[model samples]
Target chain A: MIKIETCLTPEILHLHQLEGKIAVVTDVLRATSCMVAGLNAGVKSVIPVKKVEEALTYAAKGYVTAGERGGVKVEEFTIGNSPYEHMEEAYHGKSICMTTTNGTVAIDAARKSADQVVIGALLNVSSIGRYIKEQQKDVIIICAGWKGNPSLEDTLFAGALVDQLKEEVEITDDATYMALSQYQSAKNNLSEVIQNHASHAKRLSGLKAQNDLAFCATEDYCDVLPILNGDEITIK
Target chain B: MIKIETCLTPEILHLHQLEGKIAVVTDVLRATSCMVAGLNAGVKSVIPVKKVEEALTYAAKGYVTAGERGGVKVEEFTIGNSPYEHMEEAYHGKSICMTTTNGTVAIDAARKSADQVVIGALLNVSSIGRYIKEQQKDVIIICAGWKGNPSLEDTLFAGALVDQLKEEVEITDDATYMALSQYQSAKNNLSEVIQNHASHAKRLSGLKAQNDLAFCATEDYCDVLPILNGDEITIK
Candidate 1:
């Protein structure tokens, strides 16, 4: 059976053995969700950078610089970390160089450790499951938590992904079991559960990004599978 | 409102703010459970050491040397990490120098970071809740997971403690929220849930420690509040 595990936060990613495994990195509140939406909207590719300065450097090469520091968009970026911003016609056929507090760092970390890294979010949950099932490889779901802390929304996404693929794979550890259990409990009303229980969702709501939260919580809105090839995430 | 949080595993303990906060450290399958049972059975004080050599040094000072590593009792120690072993009449009024795989490491970590550190388990869940409520300080429930990875039993205990104190304190962060939800889902049948879901419980069962797992799953078996005062844990 294919083995599956979960790293609840990027802070604990080091504890997970990602070598030779497919790493599905998730930032459901916005970052990975934005990638899924952008890719589905016909964006050429997304280059996830760890710093806003690195994203700005891509702007010199005509790439769209998009990022967020806290919940707000960085003043230097052309777009923020919101999924809706990436879903517009202006981003179609364009390459985005994106940076955010948690998502990019997690992606960068997973790329170095795993044999393959793919972006996962509620927006492409079923697609991710289908892609992983076809790969038939050991998988680790890495949650891009808020600032080295575990985020409820990311975990919820991880759980949702586990719920999708548990029957076809062997859940390896307690982290995966916890995520699956949490997802099982909250699957019926993910949007309401996340809005009420997730700290990052509350932070986003405070910044008037309630629409982003609702959009990110949506399941299978996009079938695009964002996989890291060299440094850029493109459709697999 | 008093703030309450959970450090799901000791690997992520540094991410939590423990200073001036009460740290309730738990290793439900069974280190902290052993401490609770020992203390309740009239053991004078339990000195938790991180290394086998450190525990052996106290044996020279007439303390009962007790511990386990990888679910087996250390050959150098007089007793293993079973609650039943700690509850024996031979241990009454005697001091124990104990070391275990995860629990002592977590206890040592929390003792240095938090203003006060106390041992917790399902065996003393209600008592731990009452004690923390009386303290009225910001609290962080530290789960002594298996090695550096999170364990289901420890998370379940953390959730149970959160369930007991949720009405009296502000549940802070996503970890606490996750713990509370897990506990809520499993509260009706903790023993069955743990027997089926916890990796540690399964490991213990493999080691012929099924009785220990059942004993540790029991709630309110003891009201003893084992608080770490300097180097030793004694009744608070």
Candidate 2:
């Protein structure tokens, strides 16, 4: 049986054995969701940088810079960390150099540790699940929680992915079981549950990004599976 | 309104701002439950040491040495981590120097970061709730997860404590909400849920410690509030 586990936050990612595992790194409050939506909407590739300065360096090389620090667009970047921003038709066929507080850090970390790293979000959960089953490898869902702590939206995405692959995978760890259970509890009213309970959702709402919250909660909306190829994330 | 948060594992304890907060550290499958049960059964101050060698050092001073590593009793220690062993009248009035894989490490970490650190478990969850309510301080439920990973039983205990104080405190963080929701799901048949889902329970059961699991699941059986005072845990 293939073992399925979850690292609830990037802070605890070190505790998980990532070698020989397919790492599904998710940041549902935007990062991974935006990547999935962007790739599906025709963005060529996404280069996730850990810092705004790195993204700015990519911008000089003709890559569109997208960044957000605390749910707000970085003043130096052309766009922010939002699915809608990335989904714009004007950005079609272009490469994106993105940086965020949590998501990019998680992606960078997972890339170094796991044999295979894929971006996951509610928007592309089913696609990620299908990819994992085909690979038939041990799975680790890494939640890019808010600034080194656990976040509800990312965890819910982890749970949703677990729910998608529960029958095909062995859920032996507590974090995976907890994530599956939490997803079961919120699956019926995911959007409402997230908007009401997630601290990141409230932060986004305060920044007038409620639509982004609602959009990111939509499951299986994008078929594009963003997988890390060297340093850049591209459609698998 | 006081905010309540959860540090799901000791690995992420540094992310939590524990200053002036009441830190309730729990390891329900054993450790903290054993401490609560031992104290309630009339054992004098329980000293939680991080290493088995430290526990053995205390043994020379007439303190009962109890230790467990990976759910088995240490060869050098007198007893393993079990609430049943701790409840024995033979140990009454004797101080215990205890060490375990996960629980003691968590307790030691919490005591240093938080203004006050208290042992928490299903056995004495109600007492912890009452104490927190009276203190009226912001609370951080530190789950002594199985070796730097989150554990189902400890998270459930955190949830039970959250349920107890939900009306009095503001539940702000996702981990706290997740714990409270998880506890609500299992509260109806907590023992069964734990026995089936908790990894630590299975680990203990392998060592013929199933009775310890059932005993630790018994809520409100002990009113003893184990608080850290200068490296020693005593009744408050």
Candidate 3:
């Protein structure tokens, strides 16, 4: 089997090469990580969109529009980028239309190659790997970098998936080794290590971001793999 | 001061944002890492180009055109992507134009904004960090993700840079953190972890790539940073 990899930036998408593979979409800094956190808190599903307007449009259809910019929850939206914010009381059984600077775009991009696109994050990293192995298909892990550039956080998640899945399949592409080695350096002091990436510092513009970072860092906290189908992302 | 936070792909230069920042370009799987290794092995400053034709034309000017496709060194070229291959006797003090799948594109993009764009790799991880800190300007660490997507291996290097420089500055991007965490996970199994990125597996297609992986996994071996100035990248 082939392992397809891509980084999400505004203009380019590795979607072309990811066809017929199990598309594992990761926006580790917030989206996928948040998805894992929100699901663990029992939120039903998250509908990821590329733009705030899309999230709003989806919310108009009885979904909660969750939007964040530069890391904080948009004051106008029901939820912020932080998974901790996602744990609030009103989240249960609700459909969230989530949009962010990086993750949302990544989720939307991964939608292109997704026969079965699973959200892979620090919260449930191994779950996605295990799922891919169980399905036994070609695996494509797309990192939704901030605003489409390669985010260190997203690639690290991809690297983690690579570490877990390479035993089962043949991986192709340069990104695989770049990430695997990078993961080797900072897997311990995650917060300190990622401080160099663009999104973490931008989100940290507010103080609560530490909680967001901490929340997203928890591993295997939930088993829900949010999969995108049509306009909605639901746990499969 | 605001830590310069940005991500780099094979395309989309982000020139406006990264302009005037100390740009650190990393293509760990082979390009940047191999560049460092080649330089360390006594090869001269490496040249980066987008197309194979450009490399050949440069070689006509008394330079060496090194090329790589699907990880293996092309027989026609004077050198392959492997740093080891670049350690040939003829390579000494000779300029080489490297055109790889993702790395050359990334180096080209960073050229637009770079006040001083440096080639970053596991080999020169700490020295580059020190140089950036000494400069006291915004530092932009650009990862040449695989064909514009975050390859875990590349971004993990970004994380290592972030980790090295965290106390010296700030990390605004959430993407950085995600990679940092993955780096944390892979730190213990450096050689094995690096062997798992898409680029590594792809490069290992025929050779004993495991050896290359082991070589790339050795961290902080060199304290030299290759600075990119216009079309020329200098090892400082």
Q: State which candidate has the highest lDDT.
A: 1
Cα lDDT, all candidates:
0.90, 0.88, 0.71
Q: Which lDDT tens digits does candidate 2 get at residues B37-80?
A: 99999989889999988888898887789969988889888778
What TM-scores does chain A show, candidate by candidate in order? 0.97, 0.97, 0.89
Off by over 4 Å in 3: A1-12, A15-18, A21-107, A117-145, A149-236, B1-8, B11-16, B32-46, B72-76, B82-85, B91-93, B122-130, B149-167, B174-198, B205-225, B234-236
Docking quality of model 1: it rates as high
Superposed by TM-score, candidate 3 places the C-alpha of residue A63 at a distance from the truth, in angstroms, of 6.4
Q: Ranking under DockQ, best-scoring first?
A: 2, 1, 3
Model 1, span A132-231: residue lDDT tens: 9999999999999988878888888889998989889888788889999999999999999998889887787644487777888898897889999998
Q: Please state the Cα-based DockQ of model 3 relative to the true two-chain complex.
A: 0.34
TM-score of each: 0.98, 0.97, 0.69
- Between prediction 1 and prediction 3, which has the larger TM-score? 1
lDDT of 3 by residue, B1-236 (tens): 64856464545555337767887888887888878877776777888898888887887887887867656565667878777777777677877778888788887877876787888888788888788878898877778876555565676687687777767676555555555555666677756656654444544654556666666767897777787756777677
Global fold similarity of model 1 (TM-score):
0.98
| Predicted model with the maximum TM-score | 1
DockQ of 1: 0.82
